[model samples]
Target: MKVKDKVVIVTGAGSGIGNAIAKHFAYHGAKVIVSDINLEKAKKVSEEIVTNFGESLPIKADVANYEEVKNLIQHAVTAYGQLDVLVNNAGVGPKQMAKTAEYTLEDWDDVIAVNQTGVFYGMQLALQQMTQQGFGNIVNIASLAGLKASLNNISYTASKFAVVGMTKSAALEYAKTGIRINAVCPGYTESALLDQLLATRPDMDARLKRIIPMQRYGEASEIAEAVVWLASDSTKFITGQTITLDGGTSL
Candidate 1:
């Protein structure tokens, strides 16, 4: 599909994988909505987009909150007059990873609240708008944990699995409406900012590296390229599918 002029909204666009996806979409000529709880970071991302000659809207939004998601959609529509793609990528991992027997309710609550419910709200709102417009693409970013059983982090795994399931269900429901839905599952992405947190727990981080067949972690940009294709018309025939970008680890 041609990339120019499409209006795309990317949640959690301020940093990490989300930031890469937003910038990639913008660089490819999509008018992007760079939404996040961090308005300052969003503005910086938007300005970077502008400096690179792409149209962007930097909006403050909390994907975990339903009202904020609704407002975000409103903001995007107000700025662009229409929306073509919605990338529901906002999510938070479990606060503390522990054996299920030792996991706290607070950790479970936080994971389900932000990762699972946030995607639902964004999907609901985006689908409503897309139905009215009669043409759109929705891409949710899931994790390899969605497919593989995760230990010591039950909540995050459960939420991601739900996202994958929801993506398929939504795609089926809207297949006849000219709306396409899909999910992308990425594995072992190396985030310097996030890895700083891993430094606090060396053992867990080491374990993560060992499971992947690719000893090295994947780059954020590699995942970004996959996301953009799913958002584009080139994958027009594909729907309700989960594309895994796991560096052959799943094999």
Candidate 2:
């Protein structure tokens, strides 16, 4: 019951990991704010939550945009009266383009804007409100790429590394003031992007599975479980750190 009746904002909730986390939290009695860049998808997720007897606030926002993020937080506050948890989960990858040596500034900017800077803005605003309330939890969804040497997409790894650094530094500064920040570094999960990758490279699937100690790809729910644990009071003393759910791929 650590997160019972709490208010949480989960960005990118339209699909993939964000969607799973939003649903899981709602199932656990949290009033979840399902947010995403897709307005129609966000609305649908919100409706689904309600259908399952959970409270939800659907918000259309691009975390890459600062003004939109600001308004999103405002909407949560205006709706829920108090903010208890913030999951900075909105992100993108270079799966859109695989050419690193031939990568464009436009390509690098697009990924960094959403994956890195977007997390920064969300954390800043979430921290601002949590400080005033004197209690809150912040979970930034980072990636194992931050810990490894990513070859195809350098910008993605760089941004995720920045996210991990920001998580630790902010956790240190805010832990005393009642805000706890942490990150979950997920390896290859069964997300939309993964499906897309598998669709395009139907042959590389086996090689990819062999890289991880676990023979199977991680699920979005597995990552959601980690976020939920970190969001709850069970992890009260576990700030300024990262939990890698990568099936020992880092080992």
Candidate 3:
């Protein structure tokens, strides 16, 4: 897969999967915009990219805020001349696990704000720029919960499912205009998020591994590779598709 010279923006790139995607894209010669709510973390990732791979710019933007998202896109275009790809990867899980009926309104709203509405904001703004350019790509970071029910995680499941739906709808609407949209659904990936989860529920580690066919968590780099391929020219014919990287866990 080749992404040389492409200008790409990745949200939530301060850590975890988003961080890996930013570095991987830069490694492949893409000029990357590492956007995160935390300015310092984003700067650290951008500096590391510049040191080890290629060009990168760090920007602070909370994906949940429409205005911030708009500015993020504008800044990327101003710096790079054009936008080639946008990865809506910023997301948050419930702070406390609860069933649908027991789920708090606050948790639900918080998760939806950053996970669902945030994705829409990024997609909408990126679409405007890509429409003008007449060619672009988008890779949304969805989750296994999007494809199937995740016990005690209604908010996260709902948000990710929306991401999958939005990716498909937007891909179809823009397919004729040279913009391709797609999503990657990962299951139990090893990241800060998972670490937090495991910190509270130490027993979950064995339970989760027992259920997954591979008996191990997916790596952030593996998910990044899939996103890169989707954004690359090799998948020109593919659009509105959700590629699952769950080690057969869905099966």
Against the hidden reference, what TM-scores do the models get? 0.95, 0.96, 0.98
**lDDT head-to-head 2 vs 3, winner:** 3
Evaluation by TM-score, superior candidate among 1 and 3: 3
Residue pairs with backbone overlap in model 3: none
The alpha-carbon lDDT assigned to residue 147 of candidate 3 equals 100
Evaluated at residue 181, the lDDT of candidate 2 is: 95
Candidate 3's displacement at residue 18, Å, is 0.6
Query: For model 3, how does the per-residue alpha-carbon lDDT over 2-114 read when each residue is reduced to its tens digit?
Result: 89999999999999999999999999999999999999999999999999998999999999999999999999999989999999999998888888899999999999999
| RMSD to true structure for each model, in Å | 1.5, 1.3, 0.8
Q: Report the lDDT tens digits of candidate 2 across residue range 1-251.
A: 37889999999999999999999898889999999999999999999999995899899999999999999999999998889999999988765546577877876998899999999999999888888899999999999988888766778888999999999999999979988999999998999767766765667699788898988899999999999989998888899999999988999
How accurate locally, in lDDT, is each candidate? 0.89, 0.90, 0.95
Worst 10 residues of 1 by lDDT: 191-200
Best by TM-score: 3
Runs with alpha carbons beyond 4 Å of true place in candidate 2: 95-99
- How much lDDT does candidate 3 score? 0.95
